[model samples]
Target: MAIRFESRTVDGVPLLLAFPDSNGAPWPTVFWFHGFGVDSEVHRPELRRIAEAGFLAVGVDAAGHGRRRLPDLQERIDQPHEQALRTMTRLAAQTAAEIPGLVRALADEGIADPDRVALVGVSMGGYLVYRALLEPVALRAAVSILGSPEWPEGDSPHQHLDAFCRTALLSITGERDENVPPDGARALHRRLDEQNPRSVHRYVEIPGAPHLMDGDQWAVVMDEMPRWLERYVLRPAHTTPSE
Candidate 1:
């Protein structure tokens, strides 16, 4: 399984892309987001796994992170709780705004099939996934692990449930997560259920899991992500509206 890795700046966003070394233009793509204070390189293994599963997995470094990280990024993150939360939310919003541009760039380069694109993230990255989904960009599926839909600022995901009616979203959270509690996801799921959109949107909580999940819990996450994508994004009949 030969997977080629490339680091490039597309649409002004630093990205680490992994895909099959062999020819197959316009592959199904997953634009993954890394947690706060971390960079895309941390997800190298996950990116490789996604590539082996027949995808052009692109790891995105959210603003104030990775190559774009500001010199005082660590200090800002280490600030008091309320101050840090605000900073993180701002970065999430900025990063989410950049996604549409990156999607257009990827499609133009013929590296990602515009129709088979998905978003996956963890923690603050997961928050980014939800923020991006609120946009007009048409995504086939999304997986948010240990993420939240609430922004605590402008335009939270709860305010735009209708936008997600066409895209399938699977949210995974730890039952014992206090840093970013599962309540946000639980509330969103209940709302989505009420909307009753044809698209699949579900939330899963790992028993006895914490904000920073252990190896066994991660196993469940790794297993569930591929299964969800295979069923919703890789299936031939699965189609999403063009952006």
Candidate 2:
């Protein structure tokens, strides 16, 4: 079935909302970030499926992609732009400014759990989530698929991974990935474990998954997310049923 599409203004920026009918009322919500590319972040089928799991899914193109109607007020990102280390980092921070609006819109529609929202970002989007939230506390949980964190001035980006994994994050990397490398992911895994140590972090090296996962892997990763949202985001912090 075709996923229904909707749109609205967030801080004067056009953001896209998608959902598939699963007959569930007031689904949880996930703010997803698409990987870097010229591909339209618009109309992503997987993103829309969040609705089918009794949750709403919201996504936006950074100032440049898709609708192209947001304030690109941040410093101009470098070219191939997203490829430029500095540009990507700047764009990630700028995009974070818009998340509040995205959350408000979905909550106002009454299509999502106002308090049970989560974030799932890929590539640049993933990195942005880390840079923006500094932790996954804003939402229920965050799935960062191959997202790398950029270090502060005079620091290597890789050096910041530990401090960056400050949430219930599923840090995934391909065992043979060249872009981020297994060692980098491991370094991140160690830092997250050392910093938070409460098991909020899960590092998985796909037997050989690359920058992006294939169909089977994608399906598995997507399906597992709803459960995570239910446990961490939807369920209240501490409510045990009336005795």
Candidate 3:
């Protein structure tokens, strides 16, 4: 089926909405978050592919970036590596805080089925997925590509393990990624595995890949991600019973 893309702002958040051209009502939705320094526009192809795979896809500009770029953004960008990471950490938290409301708003507007929502993020956006998992929203599944759940200074993002247990999760990282470290991603998978034995949890390490993936790696991600979501998140049989 063909897909259509629309750019809109909801509650001050700039978003790109992708849906099938067919008149489908209250479609299942996947929220896509982009990497640092880039906006939703950069992920249009991926978002559209998701929509093509029978989802109402949404891409949001994270706080302090893209359409919501902060006034001190240039200064912050010029900060030391540690400082920049800290700033992004805070911003990711804020963005995660806003997601539930955005989901509710989409539901209220009859744009998507709130109960059938998932999340996908890359790099900085991937870190936001970890933050969002700490929240109490009813996400069916989530995917983090080239990202880590470990915060700086040992601050954990696993406080809401039970909530996380209720959703299927896929973590993909480059085996050679020094920026985020693949070890942390593997540890996260192990922790989640130990905590929730029944939930669908997968951690994939792309061989010979770096912090930034090449076109082939992205092709693999684009192909496998939507299928994973369809099997574990969209299909009714895979739904997690409420705790």
Candidate 4:
């Protein structure tokens, strides 16, 4: 079935909503976050796949990115690597904090099932997923592609790992990803495993892939991510009767 797409702005946050052609109320939802400098539209294919897998997929424009680019973006764009990292850290944190409210708004509008919410992000979006885990949102699962639990100087990504241990997590990265080193991804998996031995935690390393996935690598993601969410989020919900 072809997925239908719509553009919406909820309380100043620009979003792209995707769902199957069938009329389904309160569909299970996955909030997608794109990489730096990219807009939600760039992820239409992936979001469509997610919607095909029985999810109402949503993609949001990160602050100062995509259509939300600021007028003074050139100055921030020219900043040093560390400075840019700091800026991304702050933005990711702020965006993470706003997600719960956004989810609630979606639920109120009868567009999303709040109880089955999940997150999927790549690169900076992946980093935002990590940050979002720190908050008290009722996220059922999360997939972080080319993301990590490390932050710039003065930031502590570890403190939240324990908090995140309660939710199912899947962290994927390229074996040759220079932007987010493979070692860090491995270490994050190890830490999460150690913190919560009972939770479902899986780490995947795509061989010969880079920070940005090519068509084949993305195909792998398109296949695996929905399966992961189905296992941890959808399947369980299907078996459990609503209160």
Index of the highest-TM-score prediction: 1
Error of 4 at 206 (Å): 1.0
Q: In terms of TM-score, how similar is model 3 to the real structure? A: 0.93
The digit string of per-residue lDDT tens for model 4 on 18-98 reads 986667778888999987666799999888888888899999888877678767766775788778777777777777888
Give a tens-digit lDDT track for model 2, residues 50-161: 6565566777776555567334523343344434656566666667667777677666777766566677777767676666555323555667666665433333445555
Give candidate 4's total backbone clashes. 0
Error of 3 at 85 (Å): 0.6
- My TM-score estimates for the predictions, one after another, are 0.95, 0.76, 0.93, 0.92
**Ranking of models by TM-score:** 1, 3, 4, 2
The candidate maximizing lDDT is 1
- Candidate 3: residue pairs that collide: none
Of candidates 3 and 1, the better by lDDT: 1
| lDDT string, candidate 1, 1-243, tens digits | 999899999988999999866587788889999898999999999899888888899999899898899999999989997788789888988998887888889999988887788999999988888888887677888999998887677777778887766778999999999888999888989887876646578789999999998999999999999887776777563445322
- Return model 4's CA RMSD, one decimal: 2.6
Off by over 4 Å in 4: 236-243
Question: Whole-model lDDT for model 1 versus the true structure?
Answer: 0.86
- Give the range where candidate 1 is weakest over 10 consecutive residues by summed lDDT: 234-243
Q: What's the candidate order when arranged by decreasing lDDT?
A: 1, 3, 4, 2
